[model samples]
Target: MVTRRRLPRAFFERPTLQVARQVLGQRLVRLEPEGGRLAGLIVEAEAYVGSEDLGCHARAGRTARNASMWGPPGHAYVYFTYGMHWMLNLVTEREGFPAAVLVRALLPTEGVEVMRRRRRGRPERELTDGPAKICQALAIDRELDGHDLCNPDSRLFLEAGPGVPEQAVTTGPRVGLNSVAEPWKSIPWRFQVRPEYIPSLAEEEQTP
Candidate 1:
C-alpha cells in the first residue's frame, strides 16, 4: 500500500533523533516463512544516542550483547529484555556510532490474521503497542540481530508510508528510562504519532 520504496541507507544514517521521528509513519514489513507478508505502520520510537547518554545501552560500552549497535546503520539490533520479551531496535548513526532507535509501537497494516495468531488473542490495539509487544506480534527475535534492513532479501525491511507531520507527532521522555537521571532522562527523544492517526487492522473487503 506504500507508494515509495523502502527507506534508503542514507535515510537512516542521519542523526539518531531525526531517524526516530522520521520512522513514525514508516511501514515495517516482515516476510514470513510461509510466503506471506505482515506489516505495520511504525507509530512510536525512541532514540538512544552514544555512551555519554545514560539512557543508551552503549553508556556501559560495548559488550557481546550490544555489538550490533556498533555495526552498520539500517541493521536490526534485536535483543531480549527482562528475561521475557525481545525488543527490536534499528541501528542508526552509521558504523561505530552505536546509536539506535527502538521501535515502540505499530499500527497494523497488513496480514492482520497472521499478527493475531502470533500475538495470541490480545485486543488489536494491545497487540503491537509496546516495544516488546511489537516484537512478539511481528515474530522478531535475536535471530534477526544485525540483519541488514537495507537489503531486500532480509526477512525484515522498512517501507515508506505516509509522512507524519511534525504537528502530528507527540514528543516526550523516552519510556522505561526511570533509572537514568538528569537531562538524558528528560530529553524528548521519544516520538509517537497521534492516536487518532492509528488505523485499525480490519482491511476493506475485496471483490473477486
Candidate 2:
C-alpha cells in the first residue's frame, strides 16, 4: 500500500510560477468511496499570476466565479471552459496574490485500469495527457471545486511521487493562449513529460 503524503499548505503559499515549475512529477491522489486510491504523475502545468496576467481570471478581480482563486493557497480552483470541460488549478501564493498553477497534464500510474474505463474508449495517448483529458481520466469535476488540497480527507489531494529529473522534464510556451503579449506569453512555463512516456496517439485508434 502506498502511504500518501498530503502536501503542506506552505508548499502552495508561494509564487505561482515557482509552484508551476516545481509541481512537475508530484503525485495527484484521489480518494475513492470504497477506500480505494487513484493517483497519477503530474507531467504538465502552467502558471497564472494575479491581475497582471491578462490570461488569468483574476484580471477581472474577485468575482463569484473566481473567488476561490483569491482565497488562501492549497485550494482547488476548478472551472468550466469552452462550455464543455472542467479544468483543475491549484491555488498558490498568499491571500491577495491570486495566483494558481494549472494542472495541464498527467501520466497515468496507479488506477490506470480505472482511468481507462473512465476514458470511455479514448486512446491511451489521450487518456491523461491534457487538462480536460486528465480531469476526465481522473474523474475530477466541478463538485471538487474549492476542496482543500492540503487536507488528507479531501477527495482530491497531492503527494510526493517519483521525481522527474530536470533532464526528463521539458519546458515550453503554454498551449491555447496566443493573444497574451510578450514575456508572459513567451514564458516557458508549460512543462511536460519527456517524449518517451507520452504515448503516440497517431499510432493507435480509440478502443471501444
Candidate 3:
C-alpha cells in the first residue's frame, strides 16, 4: 500500500515552468468510485508559461478551449488534442498567470490491473505512458476540467514520491511542436524517466 502525500496549494502557486521541472518522479493519483485507487509515477512533463509561450493555449487568452488555464492553481486543465485524444494538464502559478504543467508520461505503479483494463487491448507500453494515453488509462476527460487537484474529494491529485536523481533525469525538446520556432520550441524543457524504464513501442503494444 503506497501512502500518497498531497502537495500543498502553495506548491502550485509558483512559476509553472519551474513546477513542471520539479514535478518529475512525483506520483499522480486518481480515486475510483468504488473506493479503489489508481496511481503512477510521473516520468515526463512539459511546461507552458503564459502568452509568451507560443506552444501554450494561453497565448490566445480565455477562449472556450483555454478558459480553465486562467483559473487558480491546483486545477485540472484537461483538453483535446489532434482531434482525437484528451491530454491532462495541471494549472500552475497564481490566478491570471495562465501557466500549466503537461503530464506527458507516467510509469504505471499502483492499480495497474485497472489501467490495463481501461486501456482495453492496447500494449502495456502504451498503457499510461503518454499524455493522451495517461488520461485514457486513468479515465480522465473533459468532465474533469477545472477539478481541484488539491481537494481530498477530487478524483485527481498529486503525491510526493521518491526523488529522481539529477543525473537520472534527462531533458529534451517537446514533441509535436515543430511550428513554434525559436527558443520556445528548443527550450529543452521536456523531462523524462531514465531510458531503461521507458516503455518500448513493442512493449506498449502488448495488452496487459
lDDT of 1 by residue, 67-128 (tens): 99999999999999899999999999879999999999988877888888888987787888
lDDT of 1 at 184: 95
TM-score of each: 0.93, 0.88, 0.90
lDDT values, one for every candidate: 0.86, 0.80, 0.83
Query: Cα lDDT of model 2 overall?
Result: 0.80
Candidate 2 regions with alpha-carbon error over 4 angstroms: 1-3, 197-208
Top-scoring candidate (lDDT): 1
Q: What range of 10 consecutive residues in model 1 has the weakest lDDT sum?
A: 199-208
Residue-wise lDDT of candidate 3 within 86-200, one digit each (tens)?
9999899999888899999888777788899999967777898789889989999999999999987887999886646677678888878888878888888787768764444
How much does candidate 1 score in TM-score?
0.93
Q: Arrange candidates, best TM-score first.
A: 1, 3, 2
Q: Candidate 3 versus the native: TM-score?
A: 0.90
* Candidate 2 lDDT tens digits, 5-117: 77899989988877887787778988778777777778789988899887788987888788889888999999988998989999999987788899987766677777888
Winning candidate number (TM-score): 1
The C-alpha RMSD in Å for every predicted model, in order, reads: 2.6, 5.2, 4.6
